[model samples]
Target: MDRHYQNLVQKLEEITHLNGVMSTLGWDQEVMMPAGASEARAKQIAALAGVIHERMTDPALGDCLNELKEKNFDHLNEVERCNIREALHSYELETKVPKRLVQELAELGSRGQGIWVIARQENKFSDFAPVLKRFLELKTEWAQRISPELKPYDANIDLFERGTTMDMITPIFECLKQELIPLIEAIQSQPLQPDTSFLQGRFALDKQEALARAISQDIGFNIAQGRIDVSVHPFCGGSHPTDVRITTRYKDSDFIESLYSVIHETGHALYEQGRPHELGDVPASESLTMGIHESQSLFWERMVAQSKPFCSHYFDTIRAAFPENLKSADVDSFYRAINTCKPDLIRVEADEVTYPLHVILRYEIEKGLFEGSMRVDDLPEIWNESMQKYLGIKPPSDTLGVLQDSHWSGGAFGYFPSYTLGAMYACQFYNTLLREQPDTKKNIASGNFAPIKVWLNEKIHRQGRLYTPQELVQRVTGEALNPDHFIGYLKTKYGEIYQLG
Candidate 1:
């Protein structure tokens, strides 16, 4: 191996280690940190962010990368080339922004999250607006500094889903709206709706946790390497694959929320655990993008868990866990109940057909905010208006309305589009999986998920950042991202469930 390349790898590994530490702190803040420690945690996170920024923007690292790029460029293997390319990309972006801004963003993110939590619980966006406004301002400035050529919002979107822009996403979303709105309207107009009354009753939290954990393990989340906990909002986060942490909130009245949150997050953990273990602490070993990461989660959540076969396989276990609540329920009713389509205030709890609309609503509001057409003060009204426009319903309060998500609190301005994009990717990937395997549903129904897990590991997870999201999608599915796959998936599944034809 080249000496300069070796030097670059060592430095990159150190940065990755520091990043893992930051992630650990973040996980603790959400899952285990006391309420009183918010201020200190913010400072700690900020100081570490400054250090990571310094390491990322180090002059020595740049010199090494330049040497590798200009001199040893063609001599390196594909993996080495990929590492150098990704490293240079990060170096260029980080060097463009000041370390002070990075620390401020980090501190603000930590502080803003705590504030947002209080505001959300209080059902008041007012308490969170000031910090949200500041976070947005910093993020817009950060976007401009990193990618001056693009619009601030575009740059933000690119930060999460590389090479994606508003122009590209708008049409896909429009297509979804075009198809989904009418489909939802048709479903609503149907005389008979699925009997979902059984899904809304008090269930034991302990039993819910046990059932979620058992299903999580059955579906391939290695509990020995990872653990699940409770959080205000569910997420998959940890310092490394071997120590992954997943969290989901539980409501005693609704086990569905926590159970599926575990399923969704378990998808993410599987990806992390399946990454190229030998590539330790380098960009090439990281998941490609937020879109791809979300794809893995949605793949399991929507494509696997929400499917009829999955419901058939797991319904008995679910009923056994809550026999009193589900005593009269059968697998068919359970499937239809869980798959019921309706407008909802909470994005996390939304049905599959209505979920993307929630994402699109946020995407539009985010664009408006960055484009200066909207202010933080206008969020509640605008959120309500968009909700009504998109889903034909309005959130009665700010908590269920503008303050529902944790993304904006943490300066994740452009992350909304990834959820919908990931849905499309998930559908495309699953279509390919079904075509190849031809018995995936049968296997799933029989509680045999090894083939599916092994396939995903080989096809998506193990590849890591070896390919871009676009490249990975094409390599696995044999085409570009076609929103039609998602639209088609929704239409086919819902059509059957609703008798829409």
Candidate 2:
């Protein structure tokens, strides 16, 4: 490698480590920090982000990039060229924003996350609106810096999934809305359903914790390298890939709440753990996008964890975790409860069949937020109206509704579509996996995830940011990202449960 390339790589690696520290602090704020530490955490995060941004956008980095480009004016080696090109791309993007604006965005995001938690707990949007306004205000400024050519909303989207614009997402949303509403309506009309009462009761918190750990381990999350904990919101976050940590809220009345959530986050953690060893310091090792990452989690959570095969293998272990509480809860009932299709207020626990609709609703609101078409102050009314139109049930309050997610408060406007994108990718990936490994479900029934993990590591996890999300999808499925595979999988799997038209 050229001297310029080496220097740029070192700079990026140093930045990566600094960013990792901020990530650890942020993770603690969300999962383990004391309630009063938000103030200190916000300052620390903003300061670090400011320093990182300044360094990334430094004129010296641009000079180094120019030097490297000049060196390769004739021809370029693939690896050396990719490294310089990636670094230069990052520097150009970072330089687009002023350092002070980046700091403000970070500060607003951190404070907003804290405020959002309080609003969620209190079931009030008024408490969170101020923070949301500040964050989104800065978010608009940030979006302008990234891609002045696109609409502000489209620019924000490219942050999460590179190359994706609001225009691209609109059709994806349209396709889903066109097909999913009728499917949800059909499921609503069906009489058949699981006995979800089995999931609820006065189960002990200790039992929930124990079960969470066991399920994480059973699903191939390394007990030595990773741990599961509880938080207000269920999520997976950690400082390092080796030290992956995840959290899920437990409802004493509902076992599936914690159980399936663990599996979901575990999916994310496992992907982090399994990223290619050689690409550790390269962007290639980083996750491609929020949506692509979500598919890995959902693939394991829904396609595998909730599958009949997985339940058949682990029902005894599950029963053992809460034997006293579920002595009479048959394995079949627990399985059915998990797979039951229903429209629910909570997005996290919404049945897989109805989950896409929740994402679509969020996408609509988020697009409006960015395009200046939707006012932050009017969010509650818009949120409720959209929910009613989509799910036939509207939130009576903001907490269970507009204030439910932690994303927007933290300036993640373009992130929601990824969940549905992920679901579609998950379904498609699962189909491709099964086509090659026909007995994949049977192996899950027997609790052997090694083959599946190995398959994914080879095909998906190892590629990382080396390829864009669409490229990765095509590489894995031999075609571009498609919803038909997702819709087909959903129908084929849930068809047995909801018996679709």
The sequence of per-residue lDDT tens digits that candidate 1 reaches over residues 172-274 is 8888899999999999999999999999889999998999999899989998999899999999999888989999999998999999999999999999999
The sequence of per-residue lDDT tens digits that candidate 2 reaches over residues 1-501 is 467777877777777788878878878887889989888988998999998997788788888888887774446544455567678788888988898888888888888888888889898899888887777778777777777788777877787777887778889888878877887788778887667665667777788788778778876788787768778888888766777889898877887788789989999998988876465475656777898899999999998988888888888877777777667777677777788877898899898878988988888887777767989889999989988898899888888899989887778888888898899899889989999999898888888889999898889887767777887889889999888887877767767776666
The regions of model 1 sitting more than 4 angstroms off are none
- Compute each candidate's TM-score over C-alphas: 0.99, 0.96
Q: For model 1, what is the C-alpha lDDT against the true structure?
A: 0.92
Clashing pairs in 1: none
**After aligning candidate 2 to the native by TM-score, how far in Å is the CA of 247 from where it should be?**
1.4
Can you give the lDDT of residue 406 in candidate 2? 85
